[model samples]
Target: MATIQEIKIDLEEKSMRTLLSAGTNKDCKIVAEGDSWFSYPVVKDIVDHLRQMGYAIKRHSKPGDTLENMVYGTDFGIATQVQRANNYGPISLKETLRSVKNLKPKFVLFSAGGNDVVGSELAQYLNHKRSGLPLFRENFFRDSVNGHIKSAITAFLEQVWQVDSGIHVIMHGYDYAIPSGLQYELAGIRFAGPWVLPAFARKAITTRTEQNRIIRQLVDIFNELLISLSNTYPNFHHIDLRGRFPNEAQWHNEIHLRKEGFEQVAKLFHQKMVEILNYNPVA
Candidate 1:
């Protein structure tokens, strides 16, 4: 399994508590790493506030993995490094493992898969095109990434479990996106309307159920596979943020959380964190 080094994991058997590694620079402690889907402003708000509250955050971004160590809080001092993930390595599951291995945090929240999903989608599209499937890429959808995604997730979790049984893992699931034909207005134009729609605006409508079907099915499959693996492990959880949004349109482009979906996500995750940590939600 791949690893992300240089993080510290502070274990208290408590849920939703403020991060314990405030001023420590232990590798792989209190780690949070993900892909571009996390780049959305709505998705970023939670991490931002966590950092403001003196919780250190590490982000994986493009143009390579750049670690930013910032200091906050006078009494409860903590410095965090936001690691940019992309420019250096291929941003595959390996880099994630490397980052986690470096931090070695007790608790980790993995915000990943949008890239993998998009990549799989594109691959399906190209393959379908070459095969002359007659279905437009716009009309087709990639339900999920291949077993590589599954393998990556499983390998990492198993590795963590073996490395430390006390380490808690919250395998964050996919978020809602913009829905097709939802009549959303973006960039001074309503997608439900024609003509005035900007070239950059997405006009494809895959319908709410279809899009949800694609994502939910994949989430269910992957989460189930992950959970099945977790049955033999400790402190592993599958965090679902589905339908937690006010609208189904949040999943428009695949995995980016909608502008209106963060609060619900944070609440659900925060509550789940509180629940599991408080009671060992996992068997």
Candidate 2:
């Protein structure tokens, strides 16, 4: 658990990109990388708060580094003797340990959801779409959708923990927001709505009927799997961010969080940290 002593924050929101002010936290470290809805603002906000507490912050993209020997010496299995470099060029565990130990983050907060809906197929879509393959839909196969998400998430968590098990890993799940509004045509091909629907409405559809059905099913399945994962993983905990703050609590983008909505999420997250990580804003 983290104390007012010092810390670091990693912002992982892949839905929207943002650049958070790295103000100051000589004792704490703040790591924020924004891309998709799963990145930035969300992560930076946390880092900003911790930094304000007199902690030094390390801002960087995912798969950051920490050198061996210098780390907290937790032997948390975070170090994969084999140097594995994530997208942002090459890095070593020794450097990662040094960075993390420097920031002294009590726990690691991983915020991601929504993007998986579109992300599940992003790679294939990119490749397929490039050649005009046309065989690309954000959510293609419902059956294996989560199996896809499961594999990706498991791999990601493995790397995160590998960096440092002593660092509590908080895996945030979807339902951080709810059906503030339907993502799009609820009826899939039919476009569920009174009247024969409006023109331009077709554009609001979720690809095709099969695609929509598969997407919805997969989202539900994925959340279920997430719940199970949380329960199974000792350090993993699911914050009950389900339901709505109010009818208007939803973002116009079907799944994104509105400003007020995000506020609610921030509060819940903060409270969770206070209770689980012994965290508090510096007075």
- TM-score, predicted candidate 2 vs. hidden true structure: 0.50
How does candidate 1 score on lDDT? 0.43
Alpha-carbon error at 266 in model 2, in Å? 1.2
Where's the lowest-lDDT run of ten residues in candidate 1?
64-73
Tens-digit lDDT track of model 2 for 1-283: 7422222232223111221224432212333322222222322243444333333334443321111111222233333577553342223334544555555555555554444443322233222323444433434444344555566556545665676675555554544323223442322542222211111122233334534343344455556767888877876666655545434335523344554555565556556656664655332
Model 1 residue 212 lDDT? 47
lDDT of each: 0.43, 0.41
Give the count of colliding residue pairs in each prediction: 57, 42
Point to the candidate with the largest TM-score.
Answer: 1
Q: Give candidate 2's error at residue 204 in angstroms.
A: 9.3
